[model samples]
Target: MKDILFVNSRFLSQEITGVQRFSIELSRSLKRILGEKVQFIAPKNIIHSHIAKELNIIEFGIFTGHLWEQIDLPIFLRKHNSPMLLNLGNTAPIFYKNKTSTLHDVAYEKFPDTFNWKFKTFYKFAIPHILKSSIHIFTVSKFSKKEIEELYKIDSNKINIVYNAINEIFKPIKIKNNQRYILGVSSLNNQKNFHSMIDAFNQIADKNIKLYLVGGINRNFASTKLLDEIDKNQNIILKGRVDDKELVELYSNATCFVYPSLYEGFGIPPLEAQACGCPVICSNAASLPEVCSDSVVYFDPYNVQDIKDKIELVLYNEELQNELRRKGFENIKRFSWEKSANKIIEIIEGLK
Candidate 1:
C-alpha cells in the first residue's frame, strides 16, 4: 500500500463544519479501503482529538506554534517520510516537494477584504510558492477549477473538480402539516449576504410564513435595522451554532432553503437542503448555479424583489415545488462521499 500523508490545520472536531467534514470523511473512507497504515497530520487539540475518534484514522499531531502551521509541519512530515502528501484545506508543509493541494476557492486571492492583514500577508508570502510547487490541484466546483486554471495559468489537465457531498444524515422527513418557513444557515458575514436575505424576506411579509436563520450573529458588522426587525417580528428564529442533528431536522422540515451568497467555491447548504428533500431557492452567484444545476430556483442575489418574488412563487406554486423535488433527487445522485473518496484515492496512489 502506498503511504499518503494528509494535512489539515483547522479544528477537525466531531462537529461537521464544511472543510473539517470533508477531510474527516475522506480520511476514514481511505483507511477503510487502503488500511490503517496511511498517516495524517493534524492540529494537537481537543477538537482534532475528537475527530480522530469519529473518523477512526491514525494521525500525528503537529504543534506548529499556533500561527503558521506550514512552517513547522515539515519536521513531522520528514520524521514519517510519507511518499505523497495531500493538503486538505490550505497551507501545505514547505519542505514537501511531490505534494497535492486542494484550493477550496481563490477566496484569499480574490477577496482580500474578507481576511485580516496577517492572513493576507501570509497568503501573499505562501500561496505563490504553494501553487508553483504543487504536483496536482483540486477544487470543489467547476467554477473554482476554471478560475484557478485561469489565474494560476496552470494546465487544465492538472486540475480536478471534486464537488462536496451532502452528509448521508440529511434524509427526507415526512411533511407534518405543510410547514411554511424559509431557512438559511451560514456565518452572518459579507460573503453570505444575510443582510440582503433579511431585506428580501422582509418584503415577503406573508402572515403564515416564517424565516429561520441558523448561524452566528455578528452584532458588530450586521445592520441594526435588520436585527431590530428580527427581534420585533417573532417570525424569524436565529439559532446560533447548532448541532448536526438539529440542522438535519431543520432541513428535513423546512418549506424551502434560501442561500443568497455573493460568492462561494461550492455552496453546500443548497446540496444539504436538496438531499433532505427541501425545495431550494438560491442565487446564481459563484459556484452555486453549478452545484444547484437546474434543480433549484435561481434568483439574482443582489435583487431584493427577485428573491422576494421567488420565495412567494415557491410557496404559492405546488407544481414548481414538485418539479424541483424531482430534479433535486436526480441532482443529489451525482454526488456522494464514496465517489469523492474513490477519486481522492486514485489521485493519491497515482502520484509518483
Candidate 2:
C-alpha cells in the first residue's frame, strides 16, 4: 500500500474554521475508506488539545521555530518521505516533486483588495512556483476550478472540483417558534462585508427582530466596529466564536441566514444554514452563486437595500421558506467526502 501524508497547519487539530473542518473531515473520511493506507501529519502544538483525542489521531511537530515553516517545509516534507503530499491549506513546499495541493479559491487573485497586504504579497511571490511544481490541484467548487485555470493559465483538466460536505450535525432541527432573528456566520474581514450587513439590518426598523453575528470575536478589524454597531442598536447580538454545538443551536432557531459577502471561494455558511433548515439570503457574487444556486434567495451583495428586501421577503413568506428548505435538502446531495476521497486516491494512483 502506498503511504499518503496529509499536511496542514494547527487548524487540523484546533478550531473548527471552514478550512479546519474540511481538512479534519476529509482526513477522517480518508482513514475510514483507506484504513491503514494514510498517515496524518500536523503541528502538535495546536490550539485545540482535545481535537486530536476526540478524533483519535496522532500528529507530529517540528522544532525549528517558525523559520522552518516558511523556509524548510519542503525539506521537512522530504525527510518524512511520504509518497504523496496533500496540502489542505495554501503554500506547499518548494522542493516537493509530486504533490496534490488545494487552492480553495483564486480569491486573492480575483479580488486582491479583499486580502491584507502581507497575504497578497506572499501569494504573488510564492503561488506561481507552487503551481509549477504541483502535479495535481484540487479546489472546493467549480467556480474556483475555472478561476484558477483562467488566472494561472493551467489546464482546466488539471484542476479538480471536490465539493465540500456539510456536517450531518447541521441537519434540520426543530426551530424555536417566535424566533424573529436573522443570523450571519463569517469572519469579520473586509471580504465578508459585515459592514454592509450591519447597515442592511439597521434598516429593518423592527425592534422585535434582532440580528446575530457569529465568529470574529477578538479580531481587530471588524470587532470594534461591530460592537459599536451593536451598542447603538440593542437589537443586534454579537455571539462571537461559538463551538459546533452552539452554532447548530443558533442555526436551528434563526429565522434566516444572511450572507452578504463581497466575495467567497466556496461559501460554507449558507450550506450550514440550509442544512439546519434555515432559509438563506446570500449575495450573487464570486463562488457564492456556484455553491448556493437556487437553494437560497440571491441578492446584490453590494446593495444594502437588496439585502434588506430579501431578508424581509424570506422572513415574512412561509411558502417561500418551505420551498427553500426543500431546495436546501436537495442541494446537499451534490457533495460527499466519500466521492472526494476516491477522486484523490484515483489521481494519486494515476501519477506516474
> TM-scores, in order shown?
0.90, 0.91
Which 10 residues in a row give candidate 1 its minimum summed lDDT? Answer: 59-68
Local distance difference test scores for all models: 0.76, 0.76
lDDT of 2 by residue, 1-352 (tens): 3665544454553457677777777776777787766765555566665556544554554633234444555555667664677777666665676788888876687667656788798788778778878888888887878878887899987878777888678876665477578999987777788888889888886669989889855444454676687778878888888878889989888888899888777878888888888888889998888888789899998898998898888888999998988898888788787888788778777775
Residue pairs clashing in model 1 are: none
Task: State the TM-score for model 1.
Answer: 0.90
lDDT of 1 by residue, 26-68 (tens): 6666667666555555555546565566555334454533333
The count of residue-pair clashes in candidate 1 stands at 0
lDDT (Cα, 0-100) at 232 in candidate 2: 88
Candidate 2 wrong stretches, greater than 4 Å: 1-6, 54-58, 61-76, 80-82, 111-114, 175-178, 223-227
Off by over 4 Å in 1: 4-16, 56-68, 175-179, 218-229
